[model samples]
Target: MYAIIQKFHSGWAYIALLVLVIAVVNAILGMASKKEFTAKDRKIALFGLIVTHIQLLIGLVLYFVSPLGLASLGQMSDKSLRLTSLEHPFVVIIAIILITIGWSKHKKLTTDESKFKTFSIFYGLGLVLILSRLPWSLWF
Candidate 1:
C-alpha cells in the first residue's frame, strides 16, 4: 500500500507540474499579447489547479504512510530526512495556497490583463516554490 501510494504521488507530480507550467506560460503569453481572457484560458488555469489539488491530496495521504514522510520528521540533522519530512511538504502547501488565492482573486478581477497578471504572478511563484523544495534525489 505504501509503495502504491508513493508511486502514485510521484507519477502525479509529473502531470501536475506539466499542467502548471502550461498554465503559467499561457498566462504570460496572454498578458504579453494583451488578449481578452477567453474560456480556453480559464480552462487551462482550471486544469492546472485541479491537477495540483489532486496531487496535494495524494501527497497528504502518502505523508502519513511513507517512512520518508512524517516518520522521519525528527531527523532534522539529516538533510534528506529533513527535506522529505518537513521542508518539502511545508513549501508545497504554501505554493498550493498561493495558487488557490490567485484563482480566487482572478474571479474578482474585471480586466483580462489583470486576471492574466494575477495568474502569472501567483501560479508562477507557486511553481517556483514547488520546484525549489522538491526532493530531487528521491524522485529521480
Candidate 2:
C-alpha cells in the first residue's frame, strides 16, 4: 500500500505541476494579448485547480502512512526528517491554500486583465513556495 501510494504521489506530482505551470502561463498570455476570457481559459484553470487538489489529498493521506511523515515529527535534530515531517508538508499546504484562493478570486474578477493578473501573482507564488520546500535529497 505504501509503495502504491508513494508511486501515485510521485507520478501525480508531475501532472499537477505541469498543469499549474500551463495555467499560469496561459493566464499571463491571455492578459498580455488582452483577450476576452473564454470557456477554454476557465477549463484550463479548472484543470489546474483539480489536479492540485487531488495531489494535496494524496499527500495528506501519505503523510499518515509514511514513516518520514508523522513518525518523524519532533525529531528536529535530523534535517531530512525535519523537512519531510514538517517543513515540506507545511509549506506545500500553504502553497495549495494560496492557489485555492487565487482560483476563487479569479472567479470574482470583472476584468480579463485582473483575472489573469490575480492568477499570475497568486498561483505563481504558490508554485514557488512548493518548489522551495521540496525534499530534494529524499526525492532524488
Candidate 3:
C-alpha cells in the first residue's frame, strides 16, 4: 500500500508541477500583456488547481502510510528525514492553501489585470514554497 501510494505521489508530482508552471507562466503573460481573462485562461487556472489538490490528497494519505512520514516524526535531527517527515508536508499544505486562495481571489476580481496580478503573486509564491521543500534528493 505504501509503495503504491508512494509511486502515485512521485508520478503525480510531475504532472502537478507542470500544470503549476504553465499556470504561472500564463498568468505572467496575461499580466504583462494586459490580456482578458477569458474562458481559456480560467480553464488553465482551474487545471492548475485541480492538479495540486490531487497532489495534496495523495500526499495526505502517504503521510499516514509512509515510514518517512508520520513514523519519522521524532527524527528531526536528520535533515532529509526532517523534510519528508514534517517540513515538506507542512510547507506543501501552506502552499496548496495559497494556490487555492489565488484561484478564489481571481474569481472575485472584475479586471483582467487584477486577476493576473492575484495569480501572479499568490500561485507564484505557492510554487516557490513547494520548490523550497521538495525532497530533491529522493526525487531522482
| Candidate-wise lDDT, in order | 0.97, 0.90, 0.96
lDDT of the structure predicted as candidate 3: 0.96
lDDT of 1 by residue, 1-140 (tens): 99999999999999999999999999999999999999999999999899999999999999999999999998999999999999999999999999999999999999999999999999999999999999999877
Question: Candidate 2 on 14-70: residue-level lDDT in tens?
Answer: 899999999999988988999988889989888888998999999999999999899
In the range 1-140, model 3's lDDT, one tens digit per residue, is 99999999999999999999999999999999998888988999999999999999999999999999999999999999999999999999999999999999888899999999999998999999999999999997
Q: What order do candidates take by TM-score, descending?
A: 1, 3, 2
Instruction: Work out the TM-score per prediction.
Output: 0.99, 0.95, 0.99
Error of 1 at 95 (Å): 0.0
Ranking by lDDT: 1, 3, 2
Q: What is the C-alpha local distance difference test score of candidate 1? A: 0.97
What are the runs in model 1 whose C-alpha is more than 4 Å off? none
**Which pairs of residues collide in model 2?**
none
Worst 10 residues of 2 by lDDT: 131-140
What is the RMSD, in Å, between candidate 2 and the native fold over all Cα? 1.0
Error of 3 at 27 (Å): 0.2
Root-mean-square deviation of every model: 0.5, 1.0, 0.5
Candidate 1 pairs with clashing backbones: none
